[model samples]
Target: MTDMPDNIVMPFEIKPLGVRGRIVRLGAVVDDILHKHDYPAPVSALLAEAVALTAMLGASLKFDGKFILQTNSDGPVDLLVADFSSPSGIRGYARFDADMVAALKEPTPQALLGKGHLAMTIDQGQGMERYQGIVALGGVSLTEAALGYFQQSEQIPTRLRLAAGALAQRGLRPEAWRAGAIMVQHLPRDGGISPQPFDSGDAPEGSKEEVTEDDHWVKARLLLDTVEDHELLDPMLTPEELLYRLYHEDGVTVYPAVTLERHCTCSRDKVGDLLKSFSDDDRAHMNSNGVIDVTCEFCSTHYQFAPEEVEPAPEARAQAQ
Candidate 1:
């Protein structure tokens, strides 16, 4: 593993094979976002997984825009949202029925989201049409659901392992939360090749010298399964080290890393502009105690605006024409 800080996405490719993967470990950034809301353990865990997924998927894209992952269901967790901005920024939030969640001893992803669909959206800024893919949530964990989406929507062989939890240290006043995930994908190769013999000694017994595509994919998946939950979430484990530990036998090569940060697009000016769309009467009705307070759900940032600030000035309106 390269010597660097956490909160980064490291890309790697298996040499001589059409396979690619990424490892992401998030620390302070995830802790910052989750701390804004008072969520139960189950809800917090789900949201952390969402955030990690967002970072992994977003980093894989080459677009300079935004990627969003969301789920809506009738279960205790009504909504889960995570968005990643271009370059490297991620934020996530969840809404759940407190009483219902509290009643359960342990809640799984499927239980929290009883019946719902997972949606992924990519927005490439103005003049470009946004793309979205939806798949039914059939898996028990978020990682499985994501793998299902890749299989059904893109027909790509993919594997993902995600883990999140609070880390307790001796002198820390409060436990620090962290989330991490690793993803591996098999890219299509041109033309067909004979089934090649395995030299790693990990392949199935009596395998033919000519290896088929399925054989390669199966080998990659098997290697991925060897990764333990602790290895992925441990802050001490660097991405390079983790990848080496998993795919060293397969010959892994690390690419440049992308750093991630916690950021919210919401701001006072943006909120003010949204309120300006309303008429004077509507704006007046929205005011409370002569001030309109808007709180961002993703980051819990509060923006207050006086009625006058929301109303466009005469000079500004005249300049618009």
Candidate 2:
């Protein structure tokens, strides 16, 4: 096997503003997620974007833990979950109907997701309190909803664009998929908790304070407004070059990349444990005749445990042991 760079989570920092961050690029991991199911083209694309966005946001977590971004909707494409952290990874499946087809017209994010809630969950690993932010979904796709979440809930100034599909010449159903994304956020210019800068820049357009924080904010906003989806999503452009193109003069600090892999928290024993949540009748039915095989919907990993191996944990033995 050829050498592989260590996929360690090396956090990237903005030197000038003293603002720090991290970015996880998804590749091998994304394919594993997509292989879990035969999702419609549009649905798969949404999950890919979800993977990048979640990793991007999760990298900003300050402590050792996992950040989960979940999209739960009442639409045809129902659920999307992305897990992110040091061993930063992505594995998730969409709830596409059996009749779904890949040949359908592509959909805007909101249309594909339908009415839903976007929730960001932060688990700090230690005894620290876990935090969650839930915002009403907005915008045409996952990118738009994420933008709304950042602005309305976290109040952090952020911009994100993502795209997912097979390599152009490879066709849409290729075993290897390519997904790309770019994330940008305005560093805390004043300070992490400093007061807003652009409060009164609207002073008659001629007042000295017209160059207030508002003016700076306006300028920043205008700069981001010029970014196109193609630039962020294109696989041909290198990530650093993409940044230079967007913020060359604005002083963006490039950080080392973290490799995103395919990992899932599912196991046969774990699945059995979950089965314990069901009634005995259900469990009996599940293992009535022979082995019950489980293929995780996230990574398509197949697991089989014979009926004899599916027994419930013994409460008394647990206490004694």
Candidate 3:
């Protein structure tokens, strides 16, 4: 097996076709996040896809902000949360019932998720309005749900493919989890393609211009449809090589890739502050054997705090000292 490079998100465009897209290849970063949770195989696979999707969408932010992808469902896997911070920080976690997962003979990712709604939110930091889109999820994969979101919410013609699995050396135990995704959007410079319908109310009385899909976009999407799951997950093939295979006829131009890493924004101090937010009676019940234990779902970092430490503000305790 060829050695795969570290995680990265590469931006590329088929200029001749008026289409732009991003390709993300995740390696150790994704492996670490999945292994940290020790989730069952099906759950891990689903979460990995969510991570890849989150990274692809978050990388498009022009400002220093955050993009969050969350899903609430009525399946074995009840919830999935993944967020990407500005530039290249990504973290994710999944909530599932182990017994229900194990009881399944074989479960596809969509089956594991059952029925739910997927929500994507963008936070432009403090003092800025947030934008969010929600789409119902059932009888479809997460990729399809995301496409529906873009179609209904952004009204943009988009195509996306995602893959994730455990890769191991020949005749050995599975060592790592990897995920990859590619997304393409139709964006014509001359505004030739409008996904929205023509507004008859605003049109001139005698005008009869009807909107239709652009040929370039149709060709670009057809080309993207040729991508295979193995190609996306193949460590041997670089993102550039994959893009060439798909868009070489149209001459693909690539921009600098954005390196990504796994990072959790959890800390002892933060957990302590969270504990202090509870009322005195609540804190009392939480003080089990003289200490309260908190574990971060994203990173699985464990923290412990004393009751008195959280009761009074640190500054007030210092004054009393």
Which clashing pairs does model 1 show? 1-241, 195-209, 195-210, 195-211, 196-209, 196-210, 196-211, 197-209
Top TM-score prediction, candidate number: 3
Candidate 1 clash figure, as a count: 8
157-214, model 3: which lDDT tens digit per residue? 8999999998885533456789999999988777665354444477778785766777
Best-matching candidate per lDDT:
3
**TM-scores of the candidates in the order shown:** 0.87, 0.78, 0.90
In terms of lDDT, the poorest run of 10 residues in model 2 is 2-11
- TM-score-sorted candidate list, best first: 3, 1, 2
Clashes of 3: 0
Stretches of model 3 off by over 4 angstroms after superposition: 1-4, 170-173, 194-212, 314-321
Error of 2 at 59 (Å): 1.6
The predictions' CA RMSDs to the true structure, in order, are 6.6, 5.6, 4.3
Candidate order by decreasing lDDT: 3, 1, 2
